[model samples]
Target: MNSWVNASKFFTGASTVGSIAIPAILKHAGIIGWGALAMELSSFFIFVIAIMCYMSMYDEDGYSSMI
Candidate 1:
């Protein structure tokens, strides 16, 4: 679990750096809009997946109890 947590942190940091760097690289290449759109979609999918994972942590009974 600790290893997983450390790996997650490392990837999260790499993701942050890439998010900052990729746009500028794309803009220099003359595809800023396309690159930005792709990044936005990627972020949205990551968000959805994170939400799904969070929801899955709750059992059926636990989910019902939320309401």
Candidate 2:
């Protein structure tokens, strides 16, 4: 749907800016190495949470349509 497309675009743009800005901000504070580590750990946790959420969406009886 158009709404989904727009939402995806917005998130993609926001994350792109954040990916660039966050590291620069950390570098300015003189801790770029630790910042990169923190970002990686956060990304891993987010991936795990997304997988859990997707798994939870299925009905116990079997697969079900969200729509």
Candidate 3:
């Protein structure tokens, strides 16, 4: 849960043309769009991948508690 939420925040910040997709959607439709949906999904998967990677590395490094 911790890794997921952290990754979520980081991904949303930089996804879709870098850090501004959600704002653009709000200005246009007062809601997010398909592109934004794509961004979220892609970002989420990428983040999950990152988390898995970090988890593996942490284990290798003998770090038990994840940040």
* C-alpha positional error of residue 25 in candidate 1 after TM-score superposition, expressed in Å: 0.7
Report lDDT per candidate.
0.79, 0.76, 0.68
Residue lDDT tens for model 3, 17-63:
45345555564784866677677767767977998898887764355
Clashes of 3: 0
- The TM-score, computed over Cα atoms with residue i paired to residue i, of candidate 1 is 0.44
Candidate 3 TM-score, true structure as reference: 0.40
In model 2, the runs with Cα more than 4 Å from the true position are: 33-67
TM-scores for the candidates: 0.44, 0.44, 0.40
lDDT (C-alpha) at residue 4 in model 1: 100
Worst 10 residues of 2 by lDDT: 58-67
lDDT of 1 by residue, 1-67 (tens): 9999999999989987777677767777887687585777688679879988989986788668788
Clashes of each: 0, 0, 0
Could you tell me the TM-score of candidate 2?
0.44
**If ranked by lDDT, best first, what sequence of candidates would result?**
1, 2, 3
Candidate with top lDDT is 1
lDDT of 3: 0.68
